[model samples]
Target: MGFIEEFKHAYAGDETHHYHVARKQVTCLHCGGEDFDRGSALLNTTGLTFLRLDWVNREAHLLICAGCGEIRLFLEKPDRV
Candidate 1:
């Protein structure tokens, strides 16, 4: 299971959820296209042991366009959660 898959699952179950992502972009920088494919938001909890938090949340998107084969990122707003 990947982040995108997990995100979709979460979305299906409930609308309020958390997602982690490195960066946020509306369109693909490479292709400059608006079309995007939805993906999962997976958390990478490698560090943060000191904070007593084992996991760091992340939201990721596939953001791909079939016409140009471009990939972008989709981000969630704080209010959305």
Candidate 2:
């Protein structure tokens, strides 16, 4: 699976538990890992969108692989289930 499937798996499990994935679940570039921890990073810019002020400045959502420590970033946050 790619980020899509991996993300789905992560949010499907225990809320407080670490992500659990199988082989070939998460891969990007030369990165390969099964589990990930999610978070956000602030982008250096100006403005705000959370309050519908502007889109010039926004945060990037990301997932860090538990196995290889590789970080995957997305312009839009992944959906949660």
Candidate 3:
């Protein structure tokens, strides 16, 4: 598999879910897919992880597309669809 495929599988654990952003159904920008796996990502700074201060950074909700592994970051939690 390619890098993107590997990355998606590495983080694959949550059950697949459907979500919506801004009242619009979430679609994978890369693959135009609608199924996703919910995840969260920390908006880390350049040197925060090494400094052991990464937790101080903000977090964005993620929706990993099941079809293309495309990740979407949201400042606010997306509504379930």
Candidate 4:
């Protein structure tokens, strides 16, 4: 399987994984107008061991606003329980 598939599988098996997404308005802090476009990095992390099969770390997506050129970033991971 590809890297992405592997990551997903690991996340599914790890209950301690901290996976979450943060949503922010892509409007200027001064002016509330939705207008933005941005790029974000993808990241994934996995444990190193015989249980390496149970670890994962990777990027998901980018946040953008098509109104006022505002851009937001996102970095999500499974929440640790």
**Top candidate when judged by lDDT against the true structure:** 3
lDDT of each: 0.41, 0.48, 0.69, 0.36
TM for every model, in the order presented, reads: 0.38, 0.48, 0.66, 0.28
Backbone N/Cα/C clashes per model: 8, 0, 0, 24
Question: Per-residue error at 31 for model 3, in Å?
Answer: 0.9
At residue 78, candidate 4 shows an lDDT of 22
| Cα lDDT, model 2, residue 10 | 35
- The most accurate candidate by TM-score is 3
Local accuracy of candidate 2 as per-residue lDDT tens digits, 9-44: 234443321332232234433455445667666644
Reference-based lDDT, residue 44, model 4: 31
Worst window of 10 by summed lDDT in candidate 1 = 10-19
* lDDT tens digits by residue: candidate 3, 1-81: 221211222244656878988898999888889898887755546445555656663555778888888788666788877
Candidate 4 global Cα RMSD: 12.2
TM-score ranking of the models: 3, 2, 1, 4
Order of quality (lDDT): 3, 2, 1, 4
Error of 3 at 48 (Å): 11
Alpha-carbon RMSD to native, per candidate:
8.2, 10.6, 6.8, 12.2
